[model samples]
Target: MENIISDATRRNWDRLSASTDGKLTSRANKQKSLKKIIPVEYLLDTAKIKLIEKICESYIGYSIPEIIYSIAVILLQSEGICERQSVQDILLDFQKENSIDLIQIDEAIPRFSHNEDFLGALYQSLLSEGDKNKNGSYYTPRKIVNDMLSEFDLREGQCFLDPCCGSGAFLMGVSTKDPSSLFGIEKDPIAVFIAKLNLILLYKDIDFIPQILCGDFLQDEVFFGKKSSFDYIATNPPWGNKTKIVSNLIDSKESFVHFFVKSYNLLKNRGKINFLFPESILNVKSHKVIREFIILNQDLNEIHQYSSSFTGVVTNFISMKFIKGIKTSVIKVRNKNEEFYVEYTAFQHTENKVFSLLKPQEEKIIEKVLSKSAYSLSSSEWALGIVTGNNKEKLKSSDGPNLEKIYTGKEIDKFRLREAKNYIHYDRDSFQQVARDEIYRAKEKLVYKFVSNKLMFAYDDTSSLFLNSANILIPNVPGMSTKTVLAFLNSSLYQFLYEKLFGELKVLKGNLMELPFPKIDSETNNTLTMLVEEIISEGKNNQKDIDEIIYNVYGL
Candidate 1:
């Protein structure tokens, strides 16, 4: 056992160094060298396996041994030594050989190293499987986490926990600040071990055993037992429809709802929680439970929004810091140097709010706007938009032959809009007509559907509001042609309003109605309508002429 452990350790060290060297070389040479040294059948005996697991866990901090083993298996898999199934098979075989009187693999899976190796492997696997639609496991950039931590004045002795601790990045980060203060809970045993390994490697002096528990956080009794135990909780929870787990026991959405309630209960009064959540949670009807809970119980201190459309696969990520035992109101923070101030208004949608380092002049403008308008214009009308529900039906060519020309949000790239070459057209003319009409209505419940011969699009949901690269299409007065609305919404003045009001983040639906439009008379609106018709005519005849017309109208 000792010999095997020593040999395995030596081989692994050599492999690590060699892999590093391979990375510094050409792809072909790197592959050639990797193939020679890292073999598929490099087996470690029980003693070696236990030793390596302990070493990895100690190095990383607070993780399970099974997760360490899984990571090693994945690392081997990445080098083409073993497949996922093969790794699982080997682990099962190892367990059976020892009569299952060993470390619990189920518990260990969640404690995987939160280091680069575990994260990289998980990321690659997620990407390969296209798990975004299902799991919503987007990696939070470390810089953002550091920035968030710097904003708050955290002490060393304060207890910290990350409920949705993915690979324990946030917990590992906290350990860097003060290892003794950190604790975490993760459902993924592999991730828990990774996090544990990472913390052990970084914080050698800290002796407090990591308090990470592996289980469904929503259903787990462990999280519920401690009320207000943690001083700080930081996590970038999974976003969108991804990361949803379906089961016969409980619904995924319900689980999230429960988690939010539980989180509120867990934090002590005045305890702070810095969370990274999808912007949809702010205004989406489905998240009413969470929204109401925060509003009723916690004080919303700061909200920093990033441009959603610009963030590919990570749409509308907003960092929010909430404190318990404080008044339930929205406080806006511009920067670390400046203190947060409360802005009391019914229209203040915390989700649409953004923080920035403002100059004196910008601050004055903001003050003026806030003084006059107690609430955003869309406070009343900020309704959730229709869900396409299932795109497969609407994306099929056989259903609708001319559906290829329509556009969805995905087709809108940078400032340029691309026509969708593939789409589903509805056979029922009545259904198509209803969809088209609904797409244009003032309180339209359109499901991000593509419209034929229309370059403009309107969305009621706040999630779809912000324009990342350039201008986005918005609705004008009802019964008016889309061209007329497009001409004005796409104008430089409107663009300037968006820039001034929204900072870097995209303007959500709630902010859309508040956007001050150019005071054009009804007669001018008619004129603009006529101009757009002429441009459309010219576009059909000569695309270059249409471009020139658009340039002239927008003065771009």
Candidate 2:
């Protein structure tokens, strides 16, 4: 069965690629030989487009003209074919029928040297472009595009725009819904052409070709002029620190912020903007302007949360819908489970409701606990800060004896601190000075100095502190140990509270400090502390054992 499917797929590719002369002869032969073959609809379905795109991408390369020719050739020979003809014969027939100059396609092919060069360059550019940054070193998965489209109600005649359209994936998805009204804006010239070709394949409208522009959305006067032009605007904006980009028109750190503010102006009154953005913008101190703009100007409706563990390539994205002049309900989903609904009243004011997939009765109990302890621990003096500058000078020249363990932003994975190779201890005066200046006193001292057998805690001034950025370590506290606090912080209960208060936004230092810690009895705290100690001790010898200990403790 697998072999049959494989053979069918191969035959489909050949049939799609066969020349006009070859196709006619093969179609006649197939008509004479076969009784009733499988329907094309059954064979291709929605997946056929992707398969053909991939196959052409694998063979014909990535130039816009080459891709168009390849697609044209493929579509012309939809019927079964047994033999192939020369490329010249195929090109001659295609040029005559489509009225496209064969010389233009031929010229584009050499610019790539061959088909392979073109495809490789196109793929690399799409993957490496500045706006393409979602998570570190990864592009947005196509599944996300399909899922968002499936979830939304996008019909014909409704205007659609992807402001930060990369290779026109979202626009393409929208075009599938309504080809007539779909439009996109891409800064990259190559991407713009690709998107244009992708659209032109299905819809041959000339006006649609000029819709995509190779200019910055933020600074481009052309975009600003089209105020309230679109009914729906969907985009996945860039994430992280380097998102601060220099605009061609303006020299400022806040260019992207300006771009977001301008987005409201572009939408019609009550027009919806469904965008995937970094959770940081919600609560990051530096991005307070964008946050305030959203709160004041638009109605933030729905929110879908993703985990930080899903960060490396596909970032922890929040899909938000913004409507003008309406109070919006915020829906938060964690781990593809645990949904929490909160109605945002006036700025910073929210009313909470619990949404549970299992044990509906549990919502009442969870709500009770949440209400009693709704605030963040950070609000109570627990601060948050980043470990930014590292001691590169102290790094051993060759393979010398390692001195001290160091921790960076990357080392702070999930919740707990992981051991890293690049590290330096507080030994030399110079090293101490660097450490004091860089790690300790760089921003505000969020690092907690462990008092003699007191609660081990750190201050996090940054917004992400609440969402497992800084870990609490308690020393000599009879009931509460460092591990105990870590376990509690990593709990579903804490996660629920985090989502309720922040909803796809970065968990700020103020928010983290305000979170109320459940008061466990001394005996239970001691038990949890001891258990944590044992787990950490075991973790040094066997990482698997440490995982097992965590699983057993969390009842995972």
Candidate 3:
């Protein structure tokens, strides 16, 4: 964790260190040193830069709280509130009570206008990426914080709390009439200290203590006296946190799920709870527990989808707002510039209670397609391609005496396969994961891309081996042949259904099993199969005919 500094943080620290030479121990020298530094882009950028540099060099081996205390003393001195002796007095009391060393900084600090959350930013920059991921603590951007805060209705004395708040981004963004109305709970002591400092800087003119505590929110029952104590709760909990939890309501070990359940338990009747989550929660099989809980218990008010918002993450994110104890039939969904309403019962009827935010016309098309279907691929045989654990050493690029052709996702297309570009020697003992011998050596099978936006299935009868990027499917439909199934899977109508119902980039088998396959007469099946063969023999010249026949057969 200590070796996972982000590139931006490293660059900022280096740039700041290169600008300073000797220690600036006097007020005159500190002010003069600041004037010689290069111009930066944002307010408080210089302060954050200097603070991070100091922490890395002087407090390298200290504990997190000890480092935080040093930062607090610097910030206090910069604000011209407390002298060095007063700071030492406060630290002596804290250390006497907690029995830990309170680090000292003798260097002179210059004053600056406290206009932003530079302390919070500095706290985030100092921590390594691995440490943040372990705690699921990525500070939310200020724009997103402000947007989520604007949706709430803050009366004069309404109570608001941000559970799992990191540096109090949401706490600082809320516009409550009274400063005391905001509360926060964080598990990291360093972040908790910075959060309290941020709120104090925000309301510097007032004289009140910030109610930010440091403890595990799930296990600590004494933080809130009773359930239903707050008017509103909003936060971006940790994602992909694999902490084990003991609960009768849900069996998921994901940290975000427990946070949601705990927050729901603490909300008052008719109170609102908003959360930002990864898009996979909508349809992933393992996450169905929380999805079912939401569908059966709470009423969803609105959902807004956003593109990738983090530095090194690629998954798209969405913000969902749920109201307690309110039952409604419709939910409002927004994506970019388009907005629409969907019946809440529509999700209830699905196999997994998936929240597929489709438009009204797309919903009608899906309903029309499923109504005429009588079969599915739930009974089919499925297998993943081989995982060699070391592909570079195991796979070969040229043909040899004992090597066989291996296909990847890049070699698969609609109704056909590109020329195989790699080969491998078959040995079950040398690989990490491989399907049964017969599944790969079947007389006929369908090979599809594992990670793709649209359906791309190819008919393969050559008994070829495939890499993990591709998967094997052998249909067991009652009356349809493998070719007929492949034609339906690669058709335009089915592609539309897959994209609308489950728009994930990865082609998961659970999602594939939920697709509908309508009953077709012998004549219709023969005609479709012939068109598929024509497209395979030629170069997709007869694809329109196959699409027309399938659409007409489904009565679309």
Top-lDDT structure, candidate number: 3
User: What TM-score, over all chains together, does every model reach?
Assistant: 0.49, 0.50, 0.83
Q: List the residue pairs that clash in candidate 3.
A: none
| Highest TM-score model number | 3
Off by over 4 Å in 2: 1-142, 150-157, 175-180, 204-210, 224-228, 240-259, 281-288, 306-314, 329-335, 338-340, 345-429, 434-512, 516-556
TM-score of 2: 0.50
lDDT per residue as tens, model 3, 420-535: 99999999999999999999999999999978988999988889999999999999776688888988898899888787777667788988898888888888878877887777
- For residues 140-208, could you state the per-residue lDDT of candidate 1 as single tens digits? 545566656654455766677788776666765554466656777776655555555455544534434
lDDT for position 505 in model 2: 38
What is the total number of backbone clashes in candidate 2? 31
List model 2 lDDT by residue over 118-145, tens digit each: 2222333224223333222223445556
- How do these models rank on TM-score, best leading? 3, 2, 1
What are the lDDT scores of the predictions, listed in order? 0.46, 0.44, 0.74
